[model samples]
Target: MKKNVVIGFLGTQMDAGKRRKWRPSVQLCEHPDFPVERFELLHDARWRSLAGKIKAAIQSVSPGTEVLLNEINIDNPWDFEQVYGALFDFAQNYGFDDEREQYHVHLTTGTHVAQICWFLLAESRHVPAKLVQTGPPRNNTPDIGTLQVIDLDLSKYNALQQRFERVSGEYNTLLKGGIETRNPVFNALIERMEVVVSNSDAPLLLVGPTGTGKSDLAARLYELKLQRRRIKGRLVHVNCSTLQGERAMSTLFGHRRGAMAGAQSERGGLLKEADGGVLFLDEIDELGLDEQAMILHAVESGKYFPLGSDYEVTSRFHLIAGASRDLAGLVAQGKFRADLYARLNLWTFRLPALRERPEDIAPNLEYEFEKVGKMLGNQVAFNADALPAYLRFATDPSTPWPGNFRDLGASVQRMCTLSPRGRVTLPMVQDEIATLQRIWKDAHADADAVLLAEVLGEGAAQIDLFDQAQLASAIRICRESKSLSAAGRRLFAVSRLEKKSRNDADRLRKYLEKFGLDWAQLVQ
Candidate 1:
């Protein structure tokens, strides 16, 4: 015959009473009819001794009953979301398949809130088990338990799906119908992101390079929240890179009259403007270390004092921080507060760069043309040849979109502007490619020019772009090599094998000589 498996928490009250007594997990097993084949008792980290004693007691009462002690770590047992989430996650992954054996949860143990969570999970079928409420023997009658098997399948509830659809529609508007996104991971991320923004008031950190729609997404989130009546006010956006010192502080926390020079009147800043709404802090990595703590306090407590104020003020608003730089590196370098980083990192999401999402290029290009049509009040279309040619170049590995979507948007803008008669032809595509090449080259020119000029000095000015590009490649190879021979072998991988015996170093020396450079200079 198959036996029953019982899962329960070791109640603190049961563990009390100044003697070795009956814990619920043990009590259920000690019952004559219960006949528990196994007991799984969850215990908080600090009460391991109590759990051990309970486990021993259960084994002593029923020698054949297998007891498994599970340790749960929690900062505060009363935190409903944390506890519920932990238990739900555990149940979600636990094996619920035992062909002959039955599962039961002893609900007579644990805190009231934990009991509620257990019941909810069991009721929702998240935890597949019958809830067992155990009681002690009274007046010589044997102790017994009541089993409740609740059937609450969320799928059976149409209201849940309706609500989900409504929430999804809000986000669809936010994403402009998600025109360019087809990747399964990105689609799943959107669903997860909607759930996050729905309930969380904690700061959200968008980790992606510039032009990845960080600010736009933040604004759209605010709009979604407002549509749901979750937020009552408008979004307040600020680029922290544009802020500095006192001006930054004043802009974020407001300022009293006479707080500083030219402080003619009291001013409500971005934080105040975002009261009951959302504040999108772009380039937040640029914020000074001095301001990091102040922001942290406001985030944690929803309280802050305006500049030159005698009393504290409160502004409770959701925060959305965007950063292109490595905020973690800055934190390690003592440029940002660890506390602030921890808080903002709770819901961090990285928006992939345009180069990383090639599947999106065609749709986004079409979107750009549609945008152009609306802006110019004229229909615009890319010719068959022009469209494919632009897409080929856009998705090529040789292109590094440093500015990401901003570069893509600019490319579309330029092509559309240059496209006469609202039709993008082959000539327009060619011109846009040339413009992009020049733009990308100019962006990277400073670094390359510095390296080349330092190595070649006056000769760098005389060297054409082709030779300079070759020298840069040679220098990169030399830096990566442990010896001149390795660099030479890599540089002339195909040609070096043609030699009867490889004289890589000699060949490398001659190659460097032609550029008026040497091995030492290349490596350095």
Candidate 2:
């Protein structure tokens, strides 16, 4: 017969000072008289708390069972060394038990901090311990054994490892080519694209602020499909904004020799170039109404006539279009064709702004550092302080980032080039931050005051003396103001009034100094 398994649950709290307090609860299966003496306790504060609870539970269940207790405090970095000292001390003082012990741990903490720390401690010491958790009971019963303990799933771990490898590989490839991943928005966008590409064959529409890497995603998706053998053709990228009138039609539809003044011979258009592959049209909304009609026809019926030619050509390719503005909004204004809008809107992915995902900052920073290092031919690392500043800068809800990722990449490259000895230091980071803050202040000083006053009360107007914290507060206010301003004329008028506040030369100068803004840039 198999022995019944038991699970022990533990919880702990850590103070601001990093001191730990452990609270434990244990539940068991059959075999109440099983000797608790077979179990050994690790000496960390958290484990000690767990051990105390386990001991109490054993005493309640079976009073005669004997157990040994060990105490360890891991409050600092040096505590690991002390743990080793304690282990050696234990070996020197008490001889090892002849019989190996069977131990089970059921961690019930909502956060993974203690559990991960405990896991590291166990692994470092080569101790064999089973980890467990108390999930919802499978069956509804008071005594039906709701506890669960199992080995960690290595396959999930391996999958995550593979994901990180791919991310790192891409980071290195982009970095080597002098690109930076400063926007956290791209990570989420990539995940979204992966799902979109895998699940649907419909044309994908990438929409976001300008410079948010719509074209980049298009190229990457094309490459990704090729790698997976999902598509047979290459990715053909074209900037629709660059093609206008006759030029736009000729470039998109192809032309024969002597088709136009510049045409010396027959040439294939982007549609033919991307046959069986993907045709990525950037700034698709910029295509004139006529051009949009032509593209829409081609998209609807894979057929188009070449410029200066009467014969129609058949084309088949995946269509991926991108725009910096909302196509629906453009349609409402009659600037974009409704039919083209309907076609592209079949599948759409909206990329979030950079300020949305703060957690992605570290990874992006690491990626940027590696990129800069490769470019400069020297190892570069962000100072510990630099990350926090970068996050604060990137995530400020008020900063418009009109250029998005392109702007951020340029900023990071500038920081790397300006850093002393190729190492980003706290002061260097601060200086860059000061410069950025100033630029932002000067650019939006008027708009900031108007928006700030509206959201934060009229008192906000009188409190323009800015610090990093205050600037952050003002940014939040500005974002809210922009949203509210969209409602009606009164609010719009308020925004106009706010814009005027920054125009006061003396007030603007003080505002610039307080926020570390460059007044000349603002004036210009």
Candidate 3:
């Protein structure tokens, strides 16, 4: 068995009481559980005599134990920095032989500041020892004292582990802007994102359709990093789509005076501005190949040559790229550099589109309304019936939310802006529904027009764009169904429930006749 060694501070006051018979260091040496074969006592230069008395008492109580005194000089034992530095230097230079001896740091005899420093050093493994705390004999009993050994490894403690888990959950909630998302996939994504953000400084690629909160998530992540002191500089956001040609180079990499035509002054680029911070590149897929190459170089090496400058500039910045388009597909098409894609592909998170997560629509709707209220400096709310009516339409499968969250946010803003007395009534919701339906219809009109031409050939030109969506949908449904009644029932699933006759075939026939087409002709 290895010999046991105890290292501690000599309590100048506590060890030298009025009688000077009982001392914490002596108690540690005499404790049966500790089996201390050696005691290394730390003391200030002014406390040499007191330390000598404590060392002699320890040796007298435990004759087999050897005592060594270490002098640690600090102006104030209560000064945290000085105490910590002294303890740190002592631990660094102390020749500890782990193979031959077991070490324990006694925490009973030092200033509170010194004790805290010892705990920090031990917990961080700077001391490579267990902590031993001693208490005086209770009721003047003829006992040496009470002794407790504490291991600083936090993983062994259940309460600390639970607290860490709770903190991680809070981080996930904060990442979602405090909205309790109901979608399991989205919740899981946020949880993983929180872990990634907490542990990594690598470039992050946020892949999702536009209006799915990529930019907002990136900004929130930057804010979290700022709060954690991981970043000391500002978040520099750049929309790659807005940059083009030489201007793109100059804007991203900066320009020197007279480096190129129309260049008059020295410029520090966005990368340099992002030093010690984060660079959020939105719509990064829009960047040209040459710019992509430079970005890869800068990301990999943190060094780049500015526009028309032969000298290299260095900017250490964390990167986060947002892409609405499939960068892998772009790479396959030779539009994006494969090497750069490889770098960013390491940590890729795809945000689900708003339409994909309908369960989130209600809560997000409330959040958007709150945001609009703050922005407008007044609160707006929907009437009881109007709120459900709008929610029903918004969450419907047939609703085309082409712009995702942006579409919903804009719709809410419009309703709030036009609401009478800050209350959105049923009529206003009905009108807004019609407006949104019209907008989506117009947005899909071109695609519908193509399908109409395929069905009608020369006759397609006669149909207006406004009617093409409805007519094309009808034609496509008629072509897909085995009969006109099946097609009509599907197209009027809800409306037919209200009709007593339910003669969907007749209704469908008349609708087709209005468009100068029959079910047979559509299927043919």
Candidate 4:
């Protein structure tokens, strides 16, 4: 059985009287429910006489209880720093054996400041003890007081536990740039990231289409780590596609003086600069084979050789790689290194494209509006009629946000810049909508022309615009499917229902023959 130990201040007035009638110390020792095996009395140096009296009284009440008086100097009992420091020093040196003893900190016999300090210590785990507050007897007789134990572990309390969870959720929302994203998949992704970011420094890979906020998420995650003191260095962002040849190698791994033709001085690489912080490599799939191999080595062993250097350098950093394309596909095609992919694939998060999250558009628009307003020093708001009109078009099924968040952000920037006197009127929204439609139409037309040209050479120019649209849809489905019949079933699902014989493959072949194209040619 564990011994019950009670530690408290010597209550100068409450435990001072020679008669044990109203003395709290005597009440604690004589309590029938709680039999304290040991008592540790803390008192000011001037209260030695009172401390001695309390110890004697406690012993008289319970002869089996061992009483020890500890002397502590407190210049001002009300001074938080002085009292807390004194108590903290005592607790630190006291050598508590929690395995064989249960500690109860008595809060009834101290100043309000002391009581609060003790509670803080126990709550923060500076002292492994439970807080126990004692009250005088309800009857006017000389009886034992009431003892209530308070466990400092907040998780045991439902309300406090819920509050912590709510705060954690709010923090994650902030990490996503305060957009209040309503997508379930996106919210769950953020929640998982919260745990991974706090616990591990392993490389994170973000896979998504371009403008899907990969870079933004990486930057925000770095900021979160910095705020939490998990990292001390700054964030080094690298757009891999923008780098080329020797510059790419030299940029990532520092170069010694005169390493290249234009090398005027030694340059410390981004990896070294990001030591103790985050290194976000956007479009990582664009990196060369050699760079990928070097990254793999660095990630595996926190060590890599800089350009034109014989000796290797060390850089311990959290790596976050972003890719708009399928890295696994690139790996299979031998364009990306499989080893590097495996290393970064440990924690992969796929950010959803804007079209996949229509519900988040309105909230994102508001967030973007606020951001632009702060940047331009002018708050902008959409008129009542314009807000719904813009949202209707933005959330429509046919409205393809090919560029994802980048498209939305650019649209907002253009409208806010053109809004008269910070008011986005209905006419302004109509003009923006028209501009977006024209842009999308032109983009689709260009894509169709390119697709047809790739398949039919110059014969693509002879195809009518009406046939081009239908042909492009067929070609896309065929390319995505494993076989011609599979693609046909999807394309002719409604039409095949009208026919008794569902020869989807033959129908698809005939459709291709009308354009003088074969299944083999279109699939290619």
Candidate 5:
């Protein structure tokens, strides 16, 4: 019978607490159900004595159990994202090629958060593992206790956790332009695209506001399809919004010699060049009706007539179209071709705006700083206060991020450009915040204040400026929330613990009543 290979970290705190008690790792190796071939114990570099004890315990428990120590470092166990990122990278880069031995992740050891990371990695197939959880006996009887195998997909603790892991893993790669995975709608869209790219060559439509990473995603999808051998040629991209009748026609479908004033040489358009590859049209909704009709035929039949050429050209290519405006509305207004819309509407994925995914702000900020480091040939650092200051305003519901990531990117670009000695100071962050506030409020005509005035009547103008801003933000969050409890939880994240009993809804109600507002009026 082949023995199993168990992999996990050392439980320094747990084992040290009771040295005479039966340790979980020792019992795991001794357990009759789990016969170990080799035990790989990941431990801290400083824990030599602990490692020696663990090795001794394993040897004594099963005598023949082979044990090895793998030293590693965790600079900060409390930083969830950093720890999770390091472990995930380790798991991704680890080699697990022995087919003769089955692998299990011993979850009884390590920090609680570390255990969660292990489960998530395994659930996503990144670690290719099942969980082994060892529990102590019910009584203080001198016996090794019970053990349970956790299959994430089937376990009561996390039946759908596997699905979330699968999605997050892909986002860590595919939609990694920034921390865009925090948006559920955006995450699900990319997940769908993963399947769509592999199975279909039909045109895909990315509908979202400008600067939502549509263009980047289109190129990425093309690259993925190329790797899958779904497309055999290079990507050809065109911005339809920048072209017109003659230029658009000549640019997309190619032109015969002297096809137009500028066609002094023979030219095969982007579509022909994209033969056997992907042709991405950015802001495709801006295509003229004639251009739209022409592209529709090419999309459907894989054939088109180049400018000033009667002979037809065939280009078998996958089409990816991106649009910022509402294409369906344009179709209704007769500005866009309905037939063309129908052709690309098969797989439409909406990329949510940045303000809509506030959770992504910090990761993206760090990512931007990393980019700055790469470009400047030295790392750039943010003052400890800089990040929080920036995020506080970026996440404000009243802030309208007109350019989405474009706006955020420009902000970072400005800050990085202005950083002194590679450090972004609090003053720099505050200046940028004030600039953003002025721009947003000036450009959008204080929509929030207008709404507040309409909602609160004379009370809005009478309220202090700070109170008005707070009221607007709270109301916006409340309106977006599913329930009063949900809204209250968000509003009182720090204060909720002080409550003797959890009645967030009642607290929210009383707060609203202070402003002579009710859930009904605000939510509506």
Candidate 6:
């Protein structure tokens, strides 16, 4: 007898037209022996067109098999659980015959909502379900198969584990073995969190500069917590910068029906949605003082009153907050509340900047190269020159990397994508460095110019003629080419005499001396 299967595609819209028809087209081959029935539970009316196409496909595959294409209006948060429950009920009532055959739910789509709902239903019913995705073929095309699902809540945890393993493998492969070979500081923090996560429910504060992977670390912690508990709860990540005024309250504590003018129905806030797991607050410094107090109260008491509702909702979510700037500074400036800071500082871990971890730069570059190459479907590799140049750029103490690892990653990706023959050269590195310098100068043009003027005195006027940026650019070019003429040619593309005659070389020399560039040994 053929196995009974129920598949749920859980996203806002599940219309056959918008759906990746090719994905389902390939998915149908999974159960070649069993008679498969397809169902599309769309959360929006917009997906009707896609639904029709899916119905047609089902008809082609199995002429008489029942295919249910339904639309659910989900304007509020409560509707999700209700809609999900109804879908499962509908599936069991129409498709599954428990006495005749074993029913298995297969979630082929990569929608997180569907995955969560299916997980809950599968666990409740004690039914076997598997997640399947397409994998690259041994030869050319990609193949489809089931990835491991040790436990239902293990998805996030497993993903982090896999990522860690992959990154570790790349480090070992590239670095061979050296002191501080891996990101020991980051790994050690993770280890400490692993020990503390299960023991305490206090909020975790991941303090680090931007692009230091604070968000990533927070996610891994959430997964680790889930893996430890074997519980079902969603990992909800919210950027505090995106939430403003009323939206902040609604987003955190949820809203009641008619709570405000536009609130038509009741909704579950992120805290409630993330109950039993983790709520990662990125850019925590951006959160307003009132919101910070509310968050602190929730973290302290695990009780919050939803907007426009008298009833108080409770949460069991592990709060993990991250920020690019110093929270203590924000507290000092009266931007952030001290109480909230105290609560969040329970298990604080400050990630070291990329420049501090020069050992990990090469591995990070290699891993990033492979990642970008796979995404772009290109065979890209970094030449030996690329690593040294990137290392110098990333670890330069004088260089200001406001974006940190993210900026480095993006730069590497751009270089790989734009490089000819997938080979990064010294010129490519120089070009990128020049571009970054331009951006930096543009951002700090006023301040930089003032600083240069203050130092250069009478020469400051000449410095002012060409913005501080231009002055800096001229110096960089001169150093790179080891000749004023060549640097001028590269920077302005002007005739050698014109570039030299502009007094740019003299101004650059004076400015360099005034800034103590000689002391810094900036000039080669």
Number of the predicted model whose TM-score against the real structure is largest = 3
- Of the pair 1 and 6, which is ahead by TM-score? 1
lDDT of 2 by residue, 258-322 (tens): 98998998878889888888999999988899888888888878888888888889888888999
The TM-score, computed over Cα atoms with residue i paired to residue i, of candidate 4 is 0.64
Weakest 10 consecutive residues, lDDT, candidate 3?
14-23
Q: In candidate 2, how many Å is residue 519 off?
A: 34
By TM-score, the candidates rank as: 3, 4, 1, 5, 6, 2
lDDT of 4 by residue, 1-524 (tens): 89999999988878885444678776788877788999999998999988888888888889989999899989898999998998999899999999999999999888989998998899887889998888877866446767788888887999999997987887697678877889999999999998898888889999999999998899899988887788999899999999889999999998999889889899999999998889999999999999999988988898999898999999989899999899998897689998899899999999998988989999999999999988888999999999999999999988998888888898999998997599999999999999888887877567878888988889999999989989988998899888989989989989899999999999999999998988888666
Residue clash pairs of candidate 6? 15-50, 15-51, 16-50, 16-51, 17-50
Model 3's number of clashes is: 0
**What TM-score fits each model?**
0.61, 0.50, 0.67, 0.64, 0.54, 0.51
Q: Write the per-residue lDDT of candidate 1 for residues 85-193, one digit (tens) a residue.
A: 8899779777877678788888787788888899888887788787787665556654433334333455666998799787676676475445747655556666777
- lDDT winner between candidates 4 and 5: 4
Residue 509 error, candidate 2, Å: 37
Q: Which 10 residues in a row give candidate 4 its minimum summed lDDT?
A: 17-26
lDDT of 3 at 524: 75
Per-residue alpha-carbon lDDT of candidate 3 for residues 65-160, written as tens digits (9 for 90 to 100): 999999999899999999999999999999889999989999988899988998999888899999998887788655677789998888899999
State the TM-score for model 1.
0.61
For all predictions, the C-alpha RMSD in Å is: 11.8, 22.4, 13.0, 10.6, 21.6, 24.0
Q: How close is candidate 6 to the true structure, as a TM-score?
A: 0.51
Residue-level lDDT of model 5, residues 1-524, one tens digit each, is 55588888888876554654767887788777678889988887888788889899889878888998877788776677866887787776778765766678999988888888888888888887789998776776437877778766565556477885765466447545545456676566777778778788888999899998898888788867876788889888899988987988988888999888978898899999989888899999888888989899998999999999989999998899999999888886588998899888888888888888888777787787788678867777888887777788888887788888878878888888887588888999989988887887777687768979889988888888878888888898898788999999888988888878888899889988989999998766
Give the number of the best model, judged by lDDT: 3
Could you tell me how far off, in angstroms, the CA of residue 122 lies in candidate 4 after the best superposition?
15
